[model samples]
Target chain A: MYVAVKGGERAIDNAHAFLAEERRGDPAVPDLSVAQIREQMALAVNRVMTEGSLYDPDLAALAIKQARGDLIEAIFLIRAYRTTLPRLGYSTPVDTGKMATTRRISATYKDLPGGQILGPTFDYTHRLIDFALAAEGDAPPAPQASPLGDVPRVTGFLDREGLIEEEPASDATPGDLTREPMELPADRALRLQALTRGDEGFILSLAYSSQRGFGRTHPFVGELRIGEVAVEMDISELGVAIEIGEITVTECETVNQFTGSKTQPPQFTRGYGLVFGQTERKAISMSLVDRALRWKELGEDDTGAPVQDQEFVLMHADNIQATGFLEHIKLPHYVDFQSELELVRRLRAGMTEAAE
Target chain B: MGLLARAPADRLAALYPHISEHAVLRGPETGAVMVRGRQGGTGAPFNLGEMTLTRCSVRLPCGKDGHAYVQGRNKDHARRAAVLDALLQTEAIGEVTARVLAPLAEAESAQRTARASKAAATKVEFFTMVRGED
Candidate 1:
């Protein structure tokens, strides 16, 4: 007689113990500290923070360490941790226009305000890896002088000429996607929120599809800025807004060509992306997808592209949800498989009798 | 307040040794909290990310309760800040203000000035000259 497989708890405990041992790798090497991950692996920390929707580098680094450098798992840890906290108060919005920019550039103009500050970027670097970096050595610090004054946004110049489509100022509050369940036909604000937290690779592919004639919007990089922005909170007790702290952010704006329609004249439409930390690729991709999703509002024909479908893009963009469902298949499905086997056997027996 | 709470505990302890005699009313526990962002400074609220925060509550012998929430896993900083917070509410406000907060505030401002100067050194001035070609 076959007894049901027991010792699931024991097996799980042993497996976890094995995983913990494997995670440490070698006893000969020193363990990586959270601070090391936070400082040295800054980009990875930034990505986890951007996707996890949290800004604390320390926690993000710890998550990265605990997740064994798996970004999606890090994001999952962050998301799980985020739900337990109390909503202290909402912070006043950050102003990218006033950002102390580290990197700023525009592809549309040869010369523009801010003189195209490249800051720290990997764009011009050759793909070849420097093997010398394999052996641990301290990197010599490059001397840099501070840039004076604020660099005016490139979009401001276009707006001054009335060349681009007018984005009227509105004081209306935007919906919080994290607090409320996402519904169809999401507004620009809600869509942007989704894109900022969306998976970088997924958004990149969607943005690429739009550029490759799937949606076909000739996008010009109007402005892309990465830097620090101050976060302030309105203290009702003090009756004044106080600066809580500063956080690094990446903001992108894309200019897309729009032809004349019956209701509107020919003008350039805009797509915007803003994310936590220094994530230019994600920001650019998000902007492209943001513009694509605005097909209906822009009076453009629906191309039925996956990027244009807000529902599809937003729903599938989260890696945590995707990984959970995909990995769930590894779990036992013995009862369901047995039922299907019995049904097939019964059907085969009935078919043989009917044929006789 | 967050800045004061986030200030290094060892530094605070060294600067003000009087705050060590407070009772831990709540905890110097480590946890995580969600951070939020707004659209363009006054727009709708959106979830930004989770940040690791250390929080604690303390009661001074003078019967004042104080609390603190600081960024990172610095439990000592949280406890020290909470103790200071309680003391500040008592008659030692002037002394604590002079001994504790003044130094922290000065250090914070100096740090900010240094950062500003560093950023200002890279400033570029662009000029568009007329070629007289209409």
Candidate 2:
């Protein structure tokens, strides 16, 4: 006389409570404040901002806290929040030529107008865990200096000589990824947008894959610059452009030797990367992937490379989307599975009777 | 919100401000907002029902044809569809894919992963033991 159980509502409620408890952890330990997480775990905040496509650090930290330090989950939270906001007017593209740079490096040319500043980077650091961090020792703050006025872009120098390639400027406004669906054969702007909002880990791995001969495009980091850039918007009502705010951005351009195709002559092709925060690795990876995707536009033969395939490249570019579609199979697919089971059983029975 | 009360074209025109002028009526059903285009849904030979879809076809500045599909359950959905329709007609398909689809896909993916990881974390092993009488 046992009846089928039907306590799904209570079960869900208990599970939510358990999750809340798990998120808070122990009561005795000092709880990590959102400010602390934002300041101390800045890199995590950057990742969420870069991928989430939002520029709010506090919100990113709050999302990180809620998701229990799951960066992607935090990004998801940020995206969900961002989508609910009303559409504001688009901002004019920032002039990188006017960027007050902190770090500027060029692999192509050692001597540039603004000498390379190897500002805060892990490149020179030995890969050893600092024991002092475990003790939570108070580190002395470094001296700050006012930024040198307007550092001319490294690309500007190359553009004068016509030695470097020139990307055609289009008057067409770019699409918004958050509001629409992705189609095939994305242009440079669209590609860059995808790369900017793309998963840092996924982009890093893809860039690595390109280096490992999957879609090898010999790239020299032409210039990698990180600095704060002013964002300006045109107010149509007032008929005047106004400076809204400033945001940290990382810009990278990779120079690659192009063997002239039928349509063009031998020149150094460029791969561009731009991210919302100080994300150098993402910028570099983005540059590499960007170049790989440009093979078709450059009239190079389709080598059946993952990077060369526009549809494949664009579709798999976003880690969140790729992972979501990949993982959705695990959901309670009992209904779908039942249909499949019925089909399989009927097919098997038909085949057996035919054999008999 | 309301179906066409006159000619299918007039009804479609009426729906233009409500549903989407670009949308073609696939069929009719209660609570079914069915439309067909290459922009949304499972880009394949399949059928879907119970969607709040608005579609519109518009002429772009460069004299190019464009189509858009927005999913929702109201006038806002149609409005969004109209905006997308306008943009799609003007912008490059690839640009739309990157700027719009990719981000959405990323969010969808993150959600799916969270669900999967959570499910995986809760997995339990089942076992049975024999009694000594056996």
Candidate 3:
């Protein structure tokens, strides 16, 4: 009941022209370089990389600049660009154990192996606005110490005591969410992939909801580490797994409340979240949500919570799809709207005639 | 190779100065390599994300082929790294190491020390109280 129409080509072109002009802002001001954004606005770059599922800081910076600092839009640009690049190969699974950690902390332990290194975190900050930053003041040098020798994951302690659930090593080739369409009853691999790239705000809300008793989850931050880990690949030509590069990542592991039936002994459960770039908030939130989704595997009751619903979480978690459908409403839908209006008018007219 | 992947694109050029003519065998092409992570620190593997990687292969006039797989979208970095990779396999390896690899390694270590220093500043120290019997 709708008609097709066209002929906004010139208007569309001019709109883009105006968009470019607006993107530049005042002619008097110096233009911001991609390098500046990459370095200074690093957290923003990390968010785009994590959600866009691409680890290129330069492209993420460029996307941010082009999108005029709209992060979701920047993520869209990165996602589009990734499709253009041909897949070279897959890297060996990164070893977090061998990470050159900058910031590592465990809430459960008072002090453990690798110790608690606060690294760069805003947790202790006063949150007061620093006017000195407005004046471009330089920061004083941070004190140096002898280089750290070795850092181990906090989970190892619980593992040694056999207090926490153990996940045996598996060499199974996990599913790729990007290449394959969303299949129902998606495994942990696919869910983690979706969660890693999911909208940060959405995941945060879900995690918050789970904590608020919508779903029963007593979560504790066992450890959260932000650092760089080498990405390696097995090369047939070289006959060895060569280190390609290091990617900055944030990894979070949560120890949940004990759960066991008559057949099984009580053991602390765990949830994990690993993301590209130093994004601890997203990583922690992802871990909480991940644990919430594991209600089935954990043999917990179906709470009917939004976070527990895999269909809802996985389907709408993608910001690209969510934003596309959402923003599309603002576009010209004259024909569709007109048809609806006409039908309403006809119904009203028929009512009038019947009344008469 | 880790140094090649991590080092800045311009730095590689600065170290090498000049390279003998070489033929491009494969790419100085940018592509993606899927990065994988584990369940806990060590468990079932899953796809974490994709990184922008540039891979290149070059053949020197002396028939030595060098390959480089770097971390970003800089084709020039890949090319220079590839050429150096080939040169390192040749008689000029000692010179290349002194100029490029050694300097890069020193810088990498320095940077690591700096980060470790900052992190070390924040390392928590705990004190336990002991009870004295009366």
Model 3 misplacement above 4 A: A1-4, B128-134
Stretches of candidate 2 exceeding 4 Å from the true structure: A1-7, A143-147, A168-170, A342-356, B1-134
In CAPRI terms, model 2 is classed as incorrect
Question: Which pairs clash (backbone N, Cα, C closer than 3 Å) in model 3?
Answer: none
Tell me the number of clashing residue pairs for each predicted model. Answer: 17, 16, 0
The stretch of ten residues in a row with the least summed lDDT in candidate 1 chain A is: A140-149
lDDT of 2 by residue, A1-356 (tens): 22355558988999999999999999888888998998999878888888887776767889999999998889888777766644444555666666656667788776666666665567778989988888977877443433344556666677678776775443355555554676666556566677778888777877887888887787899888876555554646447655444556787888887888666678887887777667899889888988888887776777777766767767776767876888888766766788889999999999999999
Query: How many backbone clashes are present in model 2?
Result: 16
- The local lDDT score (0 to 100) that residue A351 gets in candidate 1 is 100
Q: lDDT for each of the candidates?
A: 0.77, 0.61, 0.91
Q: For all the predictions, what are the DockQ values?
A: 0.30, 0.01, 0.84
Local accuracy of candidate 1 as per-residue lDDT tens digits, B1-134:
65665566677778876555878877787665444544332235555544566668888777888777665568887888888877778888898899889998888767655555554444445678989988
User: Any runs in candidate 1 off by more than 4 Å, and if so which?
Assistant: A1-6, A352-356, B2-69, B72-75, B78-134
Per-residue lDDT for A63-97 in model 1, tens only?
99989999999999988877776555556667777
Of the two candidates 2 and 3, the one with more favorable DockQ, higher being better, is 3
Which docking band does candidate 3 fall into?
high
Give each model a TM-score.
0.85, 0.68, 0.97
